[model samples]
Target chain A: MRLKMDFMGLSLKNPVMVAAGPWSRNPETIMRSLDAGASAVVTETIAMEVRQNVRPWIYSKNEGYQNVRLYSDHALEQWLIFIRQIKKEGGTVIASIMAHSPSEMAYIAKSVYKAGADAIELGLSIPHGEGVAVMGSDPDHMYNSVKRVIQSVDIPVMVKFSPHVTNISELAKVVEKAGASGISAIDTVRSIIGVDLETSKPLLATYGGYSGVPIKPIGLATVASIAQSVKIPVCGIGGISNWSDGLEYMMLGASTIQIGSAIMTLGSEVISDVIEGMDKWLEQKRLRAEGIVGKALSNLKSFDEIEILPYKAVLKDACPESSCETCVVGCLVGALEKKNGNIVYHQELCNGCGLCVSLCKDQNFELKWRL
Target chain B: MNIRDVAQRAGVSVATVSRVLNHPDQVTPKTRERILEIMKAMDYTPNWFARGLNLNRTGVIALLIPNIMNPIYTEIAKGVEEVAHNKGYYTLLCNSEDSKEKEAAYIEMLLHRKVDGLIFIAGHLDPDLMTRIEETRLPAVMIGKIEGNWQFSAVYTDYFEGARKATAHLIENGYSGIAHITGNLRFIESAEKLNGYREALKNADIQINPKWIIGGEETIEGGYLAAKRLVRNPNPPEAIFIANDWMAFGAIDAIKTEGFRIPEDIAVVGFDNNRMSGLVEPKLTTVNLPVYKMGLTASRLLFDEMDTLSSTSESDEKADQKQQIFLPLTIKVRNSCGHQDRIKAIFGE
Candidate 1:
């Protein structure tokens, strides 16, 4: 399987890159990820000034994760040294930087470029970084800031967009107009995570960035939208834990994939698993990554353009063997019922939405597209 | 009115007026009375900020705790309050709810208010907290144990030793099949207790069953759920050593729900001899951590540091050194571990 792809004008060994996060906070972890077959390691977001992180910064839920992490506490000089060392070791390095202004970003970008970074990643929308981080909502500011960094640095610059933007595609276009080499969408979603009902205090006591399996839809949507709008490559991020998710993003037009939450939750070993999964899938499909990229976009349809075919739920033989009534209880139109220890479908009441087909845990219901 | 206005009306020097406000007995009775009368006439209230600025002490300290609802912390807060009140100082109780942001905010607010000192009852020492305390040169003490060398004075019970003693007591009671229910291991204290439990089992030459040891949230529900899993095991332990009394209470409830009698079917011992420990049925046998005394000791340490800081221009050398006070733990023998039953048999029921 040919996994290599051109991301931001740089030839990557694979489409999988370790996104800028705690996993890439230190030289050791960055090396670990690169050794585990990550195409490139994006360093933890660095800024001109240092920010202190909260204790117990990472909180994991059943569905996703939440963190109050601000940015890299390492000094810019320390990171520059790390980047220089990594580049000397023949490892690809993409420096991630966060700044409030275009000048600060451009200055950091120039320093990073001198330090031997292959590319630059602009961190614009850290959830807790309201004033200090980039304003993803302001397109003009984003375009200007991205443009300034691109102009100052000779390396390829990828603008990371936040999910909080009203029109993510429009923001992607604004950055593309500024000559951004690629787009990484989406950054962690802004969330409060949860609350302690007993104390009436929020779990983190403040808003934090949320990531993991739950936010994959939001990520795919942003990637699909941005890929459709911009000419540059789309790096799908957020909630990508498995290779199938990586494949799904690639099919939706993301040329590259960034893994952050999965690495944080499952460890860096998942990087190899994801790469292997993507390779094995490509091998089975007898296709290269470029063939799959943007393949789904051609078939993509708007809500009104979708062809809604009429269908009806039909009970399968396994319905009697399993006592599960999930579909019966979940059916909104009262189309499904359990009668005489077997599922009975009322064809007359069924709207042919085929929700039961997905809800049935035992594969006890099937959707007949043409009744 | 300002102090100068009161001084002008009283026809006394500002020093005499200041003396009357602070050390009234030092001033002559007639002079003090005159100063007081004029001050009342001028509606004069000494400015708090100005007073604090002059003395370089706010007569106020702040206590930051991870959670207020926990009884252990509430007891510590009470002890701190008692010491602060006796010293003629007020304490600002700030609950961080285990959030570093909230803790940082509270520290910032206390610093802004010119608090004389701070007492932190944190599970873990946040690096930012230590950095801020050092940067400001503020007098502060911690009522917890954190890994590595830190500058702040700390007052904590030897949780490892306490847990070991608790587990050893259960062993002495002739229970070899012992299970340990620990608090969240993410915390240093919980990890220490778990180590202590393992050490005790190792000393007794009993094989440590990994399945017997369950990690739980430091709450009653966490204990209940952990205990539920333990009792449902094919080979449940004859005795269980819980990390804290709150969880022990929950474990006891869970064991009872499983139709097991205390100390007869399964014996249980807990750490932290909380007030309710004695009141609970079967009176939990537990390690008595001097939590209140820890609070009192920590506050005293902070006060002393504040005194040292104010008295000496060269206190930086002294403040750089770490001050640690390790409190001793005692085991409260009770019926939960079936020890009191032996005492009752030896004497009278």
Candidate 2:
């Protein structure tokens, strides 16, 4: 029963950590998260100036959270003090910092490394809006900025990217060439939580970053792309909630799992729960947690390389107890039909998409793969 | 029949026969004539692909144009094809329709087919396509302006200078109430043209009427609608400078339909001397963009780039060799701008 692993030369007791967010804002919370189970606590995004978040910034929708929160309000000197205190307590701290320009970014990276930080993670995900485009959105800008910071720092430099880009893998390759040690994806997706019925204004009052359960798939896809594109270690951070969600990211070739919105919604206890669940599952399987990383990459194939087996939907037997017509009405190809108070399957109309198979909870429809 | 057969029939070596077909002037007239006679007698035709294979080249260059329907691009295509044909290369024209996805797909397809080079005749800035081209390390030349920091060569016309000259002609004609119908301002070329118009009015000390300026789509209908709005104003302009010929054509039709005489009531000038500009009634007084010459230059530059890639070592600074060429523009004064009336009055009528 070993769960220890190595990511970007940092020894971690486990693969799960607190991603850069409000959860890792101060020294007390960082200490609490480290005590709870987080292997490494990524500090809240630190910038040159303290930011003032709008009132009522967080909006809760179904299974997701949209927030307009910005960088930490604490000054850079205060963050360095917090990092120094945490390092004195023997807790691994990954400092996350951002700035408006490359030189400014390099300056902050140097300051954080001097404060006894184990590593530096560059946060270049904020969209500038208006006429000023985000630095991460342009490859040349991102490459120059990353290079400047890496040149100024002695510690391993990691870059967390925004998902809203032309080609995520292409950007990943650009940053890798710029001497990044690892990559993290993705920042919260640009989203609008909801609109007020009375005033017709957005719930967050403006467009904001959306995170939580709904963004897990998007995060997994981005992480998989980045992992495959670069030789550096990858940190997956998106809609991860439970241990199973973290495991899914590991399977996609991520070396570590980062939980942000989930910790905000459920509290720091979520980190310990993830670590315990992963440990228990690995122990039951008689395997180490590190062994599961990148196991699914071997099965991953390009569209042209995938072997599509022919499958046809089949209905089990006519039952008088059948009262559900969900699959029949939900079939996109009209392959499922109701006749004589029972479901019937037309083999000719079936495209084998398996939509109806999931719709029928009575186990009436199943897509049998043709050998 | 192969060249060997012709050579044997003519009692000569195969090299002599090849020389006759390729460098006929270098060979003796007797040998060349004898080989030609035998080839004509045997009804033999030279293989185009075999000739290309001799140089280890594809002999095919792909040209991606934003729109094939636009006469400006078609004129460029014609120039490109003319040069390619003379250089023993075939031109593969792809109409991208100004879509980033379609341009990417075409670039992928062209790369797979092993084209010798690529020529992109885009109407707007294509940053994504430029990134894709850079990733593939392809020998390409663009026929439009790239605004950002890109490491590629481009050939462009000075839209700002062209607009300034077009507007200056109106001011020189004593028209103080000059207006402009601009193309979509989001594009750099359109914005440059608008700036040039402003500079011309500023140099002439004429106040620019903000209400007279209207942004229109780069289409005939956009021009027509924009002109309709302009003419509906309480005080319409005496002269208008349209961004492109297509929009100018539409503006002319709209002004005529509104019962305004061509040069007497409202003088109109357009940009991009389209082929139909001369055929339209009153003819179009437009700026000659030299699109065909630009296509020729871009194709030639791509060929030179491919040659540089083949000759130089991979470590050479060939990838960073980028050149920017700007061809000059001239205003084509026609009847639409009242220049013809001045000429006729000075001569006879």
Candidate 3:
């Protein structure tokens, strides 16, 4: 199985990698993750000064991870000291930096590159409750920062974007025009981490960045939209729990998948699991892993161009024991039903949401278009 | 004799006899022959009034809406069409786009064309337009809320009740420090929605922080910008009740961009449960207004007024004065408010 892939101008053994965060905050943890089978390891986002973090930094809200603060506590000098060491150890190192000024970003980018970092990813976006004062969400700020960093660094430089903007594709286009080699998106969703009723205080004491399995759809959408609009390689960095999750990102035009909360919850062993699962799935499909990247792009269309056929979900007879109850609930248009010993679909009620078709993993439901 | 009396004597459908006189080719040869013989014997003639080609009325109604691209107005247009189709009237659909000049132009054009009646949802009631209507005594029914003292028939949803219910739902869900992003305060509907938001907060004993209330554009971008500003405050709102769902989308995305958790950090409720409300990420909790019914009722009322005008020349009467009709509202529970967290917890998605 040929799992090796090309990201921007660099060769990667696989598409699965760990993003910059607490998981990659230290040199030892970075080495451990690289040894655990990550194709590349991005350093924790280093800045000009230390960022204060409150206790209980991360909260696992059901299936989502709400993080109060992000970015590394150490400065650029600490990362420069070990980026060379990590590279000498034959592990791919991508320096992630978040700086306030364009010159500061360029200065950090040059130092990290001189320190033998294989790549540089400018941390342009910060999730809510996390920004000690970084500029990553705005397009003009992102373009200026990315431009200076790319001009300063000889190696491939990627820019990470936050999904907070109304149009991610527009920002992606601006970054591409500003000379970014690659784009990593959906840093984290800015979200409230719930509040304590008794004390009337936020559970995290402030708003935070939300990530995990629930954010995969947002990541997929942003990546797919950007990939179609621009020619640059996109590294999807939102929610990647396992191999199949990574595969979904690849199918949606991401050249690589950034594993974050999943590693924190499931440990570094997840990196190997993802690689092995990808190999098996690639063999099973009789295709290479790279072949699936951006395969779903051609079918993508804008909201207005999507051909909304007056189609309705209809139940077809299958085994009675089949427990794939995808069409039984969450019908926003009120189209489906779980009738006595069978699935019933109301043709008149279905608003062509196609939720049932996407959810029915067992192919028990069929959409009949009314011409 | 009238076409109906001729049809009874001819033992044929009234349509057959009328078709024989107005359109000879439409009726079959046998039906046409029998209808002609009966018409000749009974000396029957078609009734121009019943055919809705009344000598005095154009039998046309103009429907002026803010934006035809918007689904809300289109849904209402559907209702207006159904009533117009049944009443033997043709409809002229106009897109005003919330522009006073464009709306006035449409009104002037409809008047020049001598349209029998008009059913329109105005962003604001123009005094000049009202004066023209009063001078011409043209039958018009205003859709949605109207604030001015203009004496015109109107059919609108009780926006106050809807906005209040939406705010109450958020407060009941433990969301305090609520902020509201309403449409321009100049519109009567916007004012009513604002009143409801303030009333709900007052009932909950929460101080009305003047800073929390933002006069926003009626567009999605307007809501997004408003939500962004609200998030930048020293102490941001715990939840936001937007004037409508389109704005709710902007607010939700803005809040997400600002790194605040929804319902967890802040809950959000929007009015106007447009179809796409549920499809938006996190789903929008919104107030449901039956705009289609409002359009239907307004057109029906305009038809009544036009009928009275054509039958009797009563220019001014107490019973013929302008009337207002209010419809009920519902609060649709969805993800934004986090009110459905229980179900989300049970489902564990």
Candidate 4:
């Protein structure tokens, strides 16, 4: 059976999605992503006024980074053309809006809704100056700001969250409370790659946001947490480079997965890989996209759900009767006692920590939760 | 020919001729027509060679620009034009396109044109080109940051300091492991920027991880690819700083695709303060390289040298020596670097 992914009340043919980025900036690119098998494509962030003279490169030395000015307000007519083209191409398009204020966001959101956009993605967070400062980062500000856009538009609204916050779930919940229809979890992480040691400056700008394979784990964890915390459908975003990565998000309760950097490197064709891989995995597992949503999340509880075994049991498990006993010898807990070529656990001294599990290669040892 | 001879041949007073040349509107149409007709009839060409010999001036200046496609260069060109026009010297705008060959070619063309001075933007001068420049002895000023010996005066941003400041900003905000995506390492600016990043890390006492550093073409597409490669690693750096704003956009886009949130999972910073940096959802915090000021300063220095050469009697042998100059840079803190609070409160941030 064909799988249907639902985000809030919106239904998607599949869980695979194209994240807002360069592809979203143009309708042709967005359609290409959809043609490649994406269920939906988020358009580029719409701003109040276009900027100019945005050079793409900056210098960095050793550990510093720099950023140069770039961006201009795109012509409204051009945006309309792009939006209209996406609709005509039989593609689902989500208009992503970025404005200076709540009022401005509301106006832009309303216009985008009227312009044939299937949905509106409010860019609640961005890595740059005005965006993060004005709309994102601050809970109260983001909540109120997103509320304004939600009130202005009748269509489903997805608030894209910034990952820079300490608690992504909290932010997601706040946006949901503010009446956002859905959440696009995790934007680019703020980071500095490294510096050119020879120059004593940054590699790009003196500083910049980082996104890539390295961020996938963080993206998955955030999506898992947000999915478990909020009732609103979550659109998982981040280092979705391939089908497996997209599946990981779906399993973690993501209704839709957005791919950005992968499309950048592998082109829109990556959407096929994500979709095909997801389909194959679903068929093999006898599950549908909807079934996969919140699957992994169901097994997850609060942070306390994780079980920690005692050190004594961990040490005994580390030194199994099998050939792998190196961990027992290295254990500082002194909780292991060897008997008949096997290590035995001392329950009284057991700490329930899983350090031994990390060290052991054998399946004989496992960490179980206890009250 | 001499001005007097040209006026006599044109059958016009010297004052009238001057007015016709400098301010044609001041002359009667018939008188101007007659003067132009007479001048053309006599093929009255001005003795520029003799005038140069007498005034010791070439009335030409060389302008070196990094890339024509870069708007910063265009802005610098405007500044240079403003100064050069006011100083009565023609500025020769040359695009290096960040290639050593193009830079050499433009330098050769400027030298062949016998420009009195030179303004070098962001490019390296090859040994042969440097020798040729030295042989020409033209007074020149270097604009933008460069490394090595300060053989000539230059006007540039302190890229090292800028990079350091940016890194420090990220570190101060609780970022421990940071990664950098850099530009072509051949340029001195790139090297200096790398040094600043290192300095910031050292100051923070953070052990540098070599795996995090990735270099690529200074394009948006390059940044996107680089970010993808870096993030795919088993242990990707928590934060990333890109070399340029355009590339940062690519990186940000890539990160978002990977489903990571900016500043939450990883933080990003960029350079150049390009206009687009501010327009994106998360405005980019970047360095303001004072390109216009550099252009203005370079032009002023070139004109000053030209004036000095014009006043001084130079033996033909002494005409082969060249000089250099340097400038300064500033940082424009914006949202991309996690300075949203300041920016939201005020536009200047």
Give one digit per residue, the lDDT tens place, for model 1 in A286-328.
9998789988998889899987888777776747555677887
TM-score of candidate 4 versus the correct structure, residues matched by position: 0.47
Question: How do the predictions measure up, each by TM-score?
Answer: 0.52, 0.52, 0.49, 0.47
Which residue runs of candidate 3 sit more than 4 Å off their true CA positions? A129-134, A303-305, A308-310, A318-352, A356-363, A369-371, B1-349
Model 2, B95-161: lDDT tens per residue? Answer: 9877778887898898887788888864553577678776777888888775677666777778999
Tens-digit per-residue lDDT, A130-211, candidate 4: 4334247678877877888787677899888777787677887888899988888777665656667999865554234556
Stretches of candidate 4 off by over 4 Å are A57-73, A131-134, A303-371, B1-349
Model 1, B246-313: lDDT tens digits are 99999999999999999899999998889999999988888877677677667756765775676556
Alpha-carbon local distance difference test for all models: 0.82, 0.81, 0.78, 0.70
**Clash counts for the predictions, in order:** 0, 0, 11, 173
What would the DockQ be for model 4? Answer: 0.01
Residue A86 of model 2, lDDT score: 89
Question: What is the model-wide C-alpha lDDT for candidate 3?
Answer: 0.78
Candidate 1 Cα lDDT to native: 0.82
Of the two candidates 2 and 4, the one with more favorable lDDT, higher being better, is: 2
Q: Model 1: runs farther than 4 Å from truth? A: A131-134, B1-349
> What is the full ranking by lDDT, best candidate first?
1, 2, 3, 4
Give stretches of model 2 more than 4 Å off. A127-133, A315-323, A338-342, A360-365, B1-349
> After TM-score superposition, what is the CA distance of residue B287 in candidate 2 from its true location, in Å?
35
**Descending-TM-score candidate ranking:** 2, 1, 3, 4
lDDT of 2 by residue, A63-124 (tens): 89888788898766567768878898999999999864575577678778877899998888
